[model samples]
Target: MLERLIESLEAAPMVQRGDYHYFIHPITDGVPLLDPALLRDVACAMVTVMDLHGVDKIVTAEAMGIHIGTALSLMTDIPLNILRKRSYSLPGEIAVHQSTGYSTGQLYLNGIEKGDRVVVIDDVISTGGTLKAVLAALENAGAEIVDVCVVIQRGEPELGRAYTPLVTIDVDADGVRVIDTCR
Candidate 1:
């Protein structure tokens, strides 16, 4: 099942967590380019999670998640929106500021009208900080968040329906493990 795939991901060190090996790797390259096969696996996982979560549109951050989000969006036939960290020359775009646990950044949401349903996408969820900002931005734009999907979900679950991670990774002590299980 999903657990096997997650375990495999963990075993590969594809995603890392905290200062530990919640995942197999931390994506230190900031890009999954090192392993095309791994990237493909992550992309496939994203698509599957999105489909299961009933996601309509994919919303993600500007730099890191752009490639992964685009790939997943294309795979799922869903529209993609890039949440810019700062507003550029684009006019009429709704820009809002929020804090992720890691840092504070601005989110620019474009082309999405009020009341639209969107699913947030990212390459990884370390502390859920960036994802929190994305969620706030979506809410500010009056869009309902259908779910949050990532190639890997780090940290312990918040539970209680406050938020849901499409995937949970498990890694071994030696920075090697598989995606133990996915939720």
Candidate 2:
């Protein structure tokens, strides 16, 4: 199953940005050119391997992570909480500083409270900075992070926590390559 997904991604349209290469796929970039079925297959594969039992909520960042998180929440019958880029002047809302490989900004947290057991899901893990900040915010909120999952991991940046990524991508002067897989 993972092999098919890998093949599909390998054949995806890639856009080079300076020294980085980005795969414009439905799962990651949500390129409308690709069929939605591809994203479903990737999400289903991730759900199959991840142990969501005992988790109280599914948490994810805004944008790309929303689709995967929604799917997981529906399948597991758990509530989904998304960290938004915009701030909401609401009670119990918390904000955290996030720095990723590509960009840095503030992420707001809501819909999750103390004592909640959550699994953080995302589309990609590159520098691990975003996940690190998110973990800190979740911990500060008194939420126990059960696990972390990423659909694609671009590089190793020491997240200080264990994470399961469907595929690990390595890019350099040689271009993108699937160096590792979680299947």
Candidate 3:
């Protein structure tokens, strides 16, 4: 399952930015174009490895994570909660500071409550900063994170927990190469 996704990504458009070679996948960068089939492939691969039983909600960040989260939510009939970059002054909304390899900002959490069992998903894990921040917020909210999944693992950051990543990639001046597979 992951081999198919990696093949598709390797064929996708790539642009070099300094020391990093970015693969412009539709699910992450919204570039090169949107491929529903590819997205479904990714979601299917993720669902195969995830333990979805008893999970109360599926949480993810805005933009890229939305697509994967929505797919998983539909697959398991679980509710999906997106952590938005913009904060809403609604009751019970909580915000946390997040610093990714690319940018830093505040991600607002909504619809999560105490004792909720959740599975967090993301597009990529480069620095693990975003996931770290989300984990902190979820801990503060008293929610139990059952599992963490990322489509791509770009860097080896100690997230203090285990996460299932479909494809582990390494990018450099040469290009992006699949270094390992999580499945």
Runs of candidate 2 with Cα error greater than 4 angstroms are: 173-175
Backbone clashes counted, model 2? 0
Of candidate 2, the 10-residue stretch with the lowest lDDT total is 32-41
Residue 181 local lDDT, model 1: 39
lDDT of 2 at 147: 84
TM-score of 2: 0.92
In candidate 3, list every pair of residues with a backbone clash: none
Q: Pick the candidate with the highest TM-score.
A: 3
Q: What is the TM-score of each candidate against the true structure?
A: 0.70, 0.92, 0.95
Q: What is candidate 2's lDDT per residue for 50-146, written digit by digit as tens?
A: 7777999999998889988888777778899999999996898889899977889999998888999999989888889888998999999999998
Residue-level lDDT tens digits of model 3 in 2-66: 76678866676677767667777776787767677878888898888888889999999998999
Q: Which model scores highest in lDDT?
A: 3
lDDT of 1 at 98: 58
